[model samples]
Target chain A: MSDFIVGTCLFMCPEKERWMREREGLLHTFEVDEKTKHLKRPKADPSKIVKCFSRPAAGQLMPDTSELRPASVLLSTIRYLFTNVVTRVDYDWVMIYDFVFDRLRAIRQEVVIQRIRGPQSVQILEPIVRFHVYAGQRLCEKNISVFDTKINSQHLLECLKQLLVLYDELEEQSSMCNPNFEENIERLSIGNNRPQMEALYMLLHLGDSSALGRGISLPHKYRGKNVKLAMKISLAWFLKNYVRTLRLIQKLPLLLKFGVLSNLRLLRRDTFQIMSAAYNSKLLTFPGLKLQEILMYRDVEKLSADCKLFNLSFAYENVQFDARKFNKGLLLANPDMYFTVQTLQKYLPIILLQDDDAINDDSSS
Target chain B: MDSYIMQLRRAWLNQDGDVLADLLSLSHNHATNPQLGSDAAMTKAMEHLSAPFDDLVLHHIKVISSLNKDDALTSYAHQSAAIQSLAKILQLQKDENWMLPVMNSMCLDLRRLALKAEASKFGKNQKSGEVLEKCAECLMSCFRVCAADNRNSEDDTKRWGMLALVNQLWKVYFRINKLDLCKPLIRIIESSGLKDQFALAQKITYKFFMGRKAIFDSDYTAADEYLTYAFVRCHKESAKNKRLILTYLVPVKMLLGYMPKKSLLEKYNLLEFWELVEAVKRGNLRSLEEVMNKHEIFFISAGIYLIVEKLKLITYRNLFKKVYLVLNTHQIPVASLLAALEMHGVDDVDMDETECLVANLIYEGKIRGYISHQHKKLVISKQNPFPQLSSLNSN
Candidate 1:
């Protein structure tokens, strides 16, 4: 069955076809008996079928959402979430995130299915992708387990990929449609985010080679300072130059910085392990303040606690780094917050709706 | 036209896959007459042949004639049609992969024609690489049959055709920058346990690509392993191919602290890496920068700039090891390392960043020591402070 789907069309018997149809939720119909003037239902086949489904290869539209709300309602719902609701007094964030992510996903689904290929799609998607990143960071401050941080890196990438695809569509349409004046202006406006999206893609997939290579090749002029810094930090991460990586990441705009910090546990652990090997000394210790600064630890005590978890002993405000004492087998890195709660709340709207808000001002009117 | 039909029929009857492939050649059927492989010609070709072979003959003629008219898109279309027919024919063969030669040639041309078709669409509104991506799908259809031939005996199985298809797919993937897609296809080959059993040429091609992929993933040891296999076992006579392999093999090998011999680099005309080899060995960061900037185009184009950029770590390791050798002390001041970095024209590094540099080296076990922050000293391990990179990777 798997081979047949990807393979060229081939013949199959009706019995097998019927079996497959049964498995694929075979649609049953009522047949009218002319003589009796009554309807009869068809019988089901019990046998399993080893056959392929043949749908002619063509441009496939997304499946329809069974109960879609009107565009205005859906748009307003998202508007409420990112703007008014997110900025309201903080609530059960985990629960709120589920509600918000779902509402935004619905809007995205509606946009794609309805073929809403306009500045509106970018307006909708670009915000959603930003929310994934900033919310991912905000959730990190929750100090949940590493996986539970709601990082959702893959989902974030999916949103970004869709946003990029939309950009391509608009650019292609503008070029082919008329090369008209106003449409050209709108298309050129969307062009502003492409490099940023491209850079954001690399920051998310810091270790992915294709992403890094693509990021490096992006034209220097088009990439904004934050985008370029993100690219640079990605390269630094690539080379295991964590000091350079962390320092430059610190220089990124707050939201992009959060994106890099999401890798904090992994980076910190690897750095600890390396520092243990490099700083193998019983008498000599790395200063705690410097460690906190370079490693982005918000608290000195948590750093010592995490190091102890990794089999390193700390005392007298310095780390007793020894390679032999290091427990190489301990794979999990302790999760902690680098920013205070008040700080995170202060930047919520900006993080979630950076460029997404200005468009709303004029368009909402 | 009548004679061409006779030759194809004869090749079909004789089961001569190579001859059929040759006769199906679309590239060299140049200056075709107006009557050649026309719609009427296609009908005549199909009329002359019978079922199973008729589609094959018609597609071949159509492809050649389309090429004759310089219609790459149409040519690609007919070539794809040719492969679909080839897949049908290949499925019918039992206990032997006699038709693999036809599949191989036709698939090769399919890719070439696809690339040509994509190239001819320059300055258009269409997405670049769209044609090649679709071509990869066409190749996947053929790959599916080859991979799914589980019931066939080894001698006759279509599984042997998978590597060629995968190699073709890799080119498409790499060209389109879709490196991640190579993962699944790799799993199929690895699980099949036919790593070394395929033809030597195909194996070389496979290993070379896998080597480059490993480099991109930053797995230098695996990259070294694969590329060395291709480099040493690869035929020396194929200078062009060996030169190509060396493009990746050189930087990857250097990262593991093994420099290429001058004669070999000269032989391959890859002496650009030689100056790089010297700078890294001497811990001369300034010269390294110069060499890199001079050959920026070559290195970046080869996608080795990043990998070579990694060589800077090893350079630091080398430079610091020198400071250790001259001072010959377990405790070396951070100031000494700073001076060494400055001497080597590493202008941008400061004290904290210097410690970070040593921190990475110590972390990697290239050096066995730690930095004492208050005292501003780097404490070195007495036992093999600078271990050979090759030895470190071995452990």
Candidate 2:
């Protein structure tokens, strides 16, 4: 289940049409029955649905698609049902709901849903996306948060560009993936992979345009079908550029903001610990003291208990003295006095013992 | 007269208390004895005794007071001296408590004569600063004798008496700013028992450190709160742990204004980590922990503890579980975990399993789970919110 959620997070839509089609199949099961006359409930087929989508992922991702009206409508409807519906829906039903909701958002099909439901229902979907993002962020932060920095630096750029392309492809392919009243029967492939990098590049260029203070310009060739493909090509350009790739990721302001950093709670401590260790290793080899490493366990009581077992001999003991004089430069005169005293206390006795026998022999001679 | 003075000095050097006493008695006796009293004899004896007797009495009193235990003859010797000689010694050693009763008698007559002289000299309704100044001078002279002779005085009683005298002098001196005169007195107290003097010094030092006008002038609220808080704790026993506190506090004080900046925070974090590493290399956990706790950098503290344990300077039994849990929750790297664990001689364990356990533990600290030893495997079970089955399934 964890792997699947992570995998879904990593996938870019439109290019991954099979994932979108699978989402449609899941959504089809949740559609209101026409023949039932609003009287009887429709039966849900458990086996046909993806196991990964069987449970409701608490904080699902939703995006704004103002220009892609049809895709936005479908997204908004699924968003309402999953996030706002508030039924005692089983996990399988909820997963199916997310699959459809996310697919609709990805394909930009909200316009058709808006025209179908009119403005009021579609307007409500906007808040649902906003609210769920907040809710998910809160939930995730309350638990352990980790950021995977394992991906090679080179691949990082490509990953970001692909994500943007996936966003645009979802907007373009909404109708083909969405259930239509006029279609007699159709089976859409929902398990094949497509290179969705270009569409993401277009999203980056589009997002960056406003950020850079450039007015939005739709290319002359980007009309209808050509528009979606043009978006794909632009996303590919974004994927190819490493510097802009980060910017593209940065452009997805919703997911990649400072708030995203909160998800990387461990990153802060881990970074500290690693750097500390590296520095200590260099220091320990440099000269005199052989200082021990310190592990600060989270539990205070446990840390205290561990401290009790610390060997006083192995861990060097240092004595401190404070001589206060209000005048200037008093500290510099005997600055190393405490260090000298502690070191002397530690090693001087042994040296003294070694000299004692020699001194006695010289006196006898 | 010179021959008589030389004779008195010889007697004092010989410690012939009786001979010195006879000479003092003879002077007063000649003052009243009508038959034996003569102007020439009285003047000769007073001149001879006055100068040598004053030095001799003061020196003997000092020697006596320096004795660690009470001597049987201390009270007897004070009574035998003529009031003139006694007055000179008592007035000079104003801080001495042992001479209080005898000094009081001499001071009565001397004070009366001084009051009469002052009335005649300064006229009526003088502001009395001069008179108070004279009294303070007398009081300070007495305290010096007592302090110089303090070696014999018991530590506690001597300290209390000295504190009372110094307090009196301090009040008077603050009005006049003649603090330099008290330098010898302060040194005397320092020599007797320096360790016991910190509380006294701390009270004054804190006032000096906090009462600086700059902090009050700028009105930086955080600086005010922090500096004030520090000033209060500055006198604590732990405050005597200066080296440990300063390592963290110096940096903390510098960064107080700069901390709100993200770039500054990043730099501070790096600096703090480097400092901890330096402390670790020095093999001084107290210094390391002091910095860590003062800053409330629990993760750094835990990291250092792990490092110490790995170095064979400490063991990693009870604490490893908890620290591992915290770091794990932070999604600290597996390689980092492996490195930390290996430093503690836990290198024999399977790296893969250990990494998973550590990762789970970090997550567990965040999730508020139980990361404890159960059946010899480190378990990271989530708390009640996630449902028992979910945890069981994860396991």
Candidate 3:
């Protein structure tokens, strides 16, 4: 029944003439029954219909002429409605109602109905249906507000949890249906699905214990097999290492904050770990993932954090940081390390610790 | 002293080098005697020997005789006599080996006399100008002679001496405000294949003069290139010369879309420019007016009043940054932008004027955006509005 509804929503316009002809034939066969006189008809409002066809369908479809046809009309219809009319904040309740009555519960009915028809396989349709249901639920949760103006993060987290569950189930079904299902779908959906997960991760900050653990766990399940999953795992690792690095930098002494030779050993260790994760995820070489800006942002944040630590140490202990000594130490330890530290120091202050007399005496000696 | 003056006048009337040389040499012997070092009569006798001479060797004798006369003659008169003797010695050509040293000292004395004349108000007469012009001509001839001498051209000392002579010629021209007179000499230097052999300091001075000339002629592009090169290559230890370079360089840099940093300006003691820099950044016309009124003499003397006043366009460009941040979107309503402009002291600005400003900014490639006159809106590109300000180091 849900497949029929999906089919109707997708093919409602293109198949309208043939459906009317068939209905006319059936009506002629029934010969004007009293029960049929009270039947309700679906109404179309032009203002409510926004042209929200996905790019593939919109580009392939020819208006006023049927030159090409969609492969899965039902999926196309649901995709259009899901992206356009149903995703609006003003229609959050309507979307929720549709999720509860038409999508979540009714999709199961279609599955059962397909099962009852024969011993035929419903595996191919199961993941697609589950994906639609999860997408609708996530959208409804994102747009819906518990209060007048604010959204509850807890509710969004719950939606994320459900989406994760559905994602796992779909993965299982897809694998059961086809051995290369994940790879094939990943190639086709790389541009579409990754942003959705990233948006979810960003919205939750992925810093909470439950969200971060779930984020890490879901990607681990597809370890080394999926590019998108590897990217997510890499991002999770980057965020984890970034927070740890920030905390470590904050506790560092004013002298070490300059990232001299001894300090750079630890910094290099952390950088290598992050970079290895990025490399393993193929994000280092991935053209679509431009992480250079993000890496630069991390470097800037690390430098600023070091500066803040230096300032804090100065304020509390009355100890000063000498940039020249720090640079000398860097040079003594290794000359190659000076270039990057010098560049980073441009935005930081060159704090003077020793008195002018002391410096003069030292230089003269 | 009276007998010496009589003998010098008789020798001059007789046109006799032997008599003049004898009298000058006798005065030199008495002038160096420690017993008469401060004697008024001895000083008066020395003054008679320091006058400009007609004979080349005799003038040489007189200059050599009065070289140590402290109170004998004014420095201008002494330097004039020395340059005259050097020019005469160069013309005589008795010894080729002495040419380089003679020319070097002549160039040094010419520079001293030119600078002294410039400093004092006593040498603005036609006679003084004619004498300086002759010194310039003599310096040019020495440069040609030294440059033509292949043996001396490769000698670092002689090469540097000749280069110094050229630099002094430029200074004389600058002091006389006849920079045009140095064009032929500069051409000679360029064609002589010695242009690249100039030391860094000499290069800086030459380029600075060229840049100043470009600025006066309103050729800002050439001026910017020359001045920026000079400023960048100037010796870090020479603070006074750096300040002089910045006096003309700051305004040229402003025209080239670079604002001098306040710290840099202050380091050079150009603190008066701080207000202009601030007013241009904030588009504060009133503060700019106040700065102009306070430093009216400075601006006029620096010859940058007009250039500084033209910075109002950049002021407008900066004012647009506030509008960009306030609207917080690519598309800004023209009316709101106009209101912001008016609030920022751009009085009575209307939509057309605002759109024109936007058009000019887009045309200048400062802001990457378009103005939609039909919709009465300014649609700026969010990625890079006002790209010129992005790379600048903010204080």
TM-score of chain A of each: 0.72, 0.25, 0.28
DockQ metric, candidate 2: 0.00
Off by over 4 Å in 1: A1-77, A90-95, A143-147, A167-178, A355-365, B28-34, B123-125
DockQ of each: 0.36, 0.00, 0.00
TM-score of each: 0.85, 0.18, 0.39
Leading candidate by TM-score: 1
**What would the per-residue lDDT of candidate 2 be over residues B134-234, giving only the tens digit for each residue?**
64565555455545554444532223345445545554553433545556665665565642543554434332322221222222233334444454456
What TM-score does structure 1 among the candidates reach?
A: 0.85
After the best TM-score superposition of candidate 3, give how far the Cα of residue A356 lies from its true spot, in angstroms.
70
The regions of model 3 sitting more than 4 angstroms off are: A1-365, B1-85, B91-105, B111-153, B156-162, B217-225, B254-258, B331-341, B346-359, B370-378, B389-395
Give the range of the ten consecutive residues with the poorest summed lDDT in model 2 chain A: A330-339
Error of 1 at A256 (Å): 0.9
Q: Residues B1-395, candidate 1, lDDT per residue (tens digit)?
A: 66777888899889887887777765445326557657887777778888888888777778878877888889888889888887887777656677787788889989999999988875566676888998999999888888888887787788989999999999999898898899999999999957679998888899999999998888889998989889888998999999999999998888898888999899899999899999999999999989988998788888888898889888999999999999999999999999999999999777888888888887777887678877888988789888888888874
- On TM-score, the stronger of 2 and 3 is 3
Candidate no. 2 TM-score = 0.18
Tell me, by DockQ, which candidate is best. 1
lDDT score, candidate 2, position B178: 52
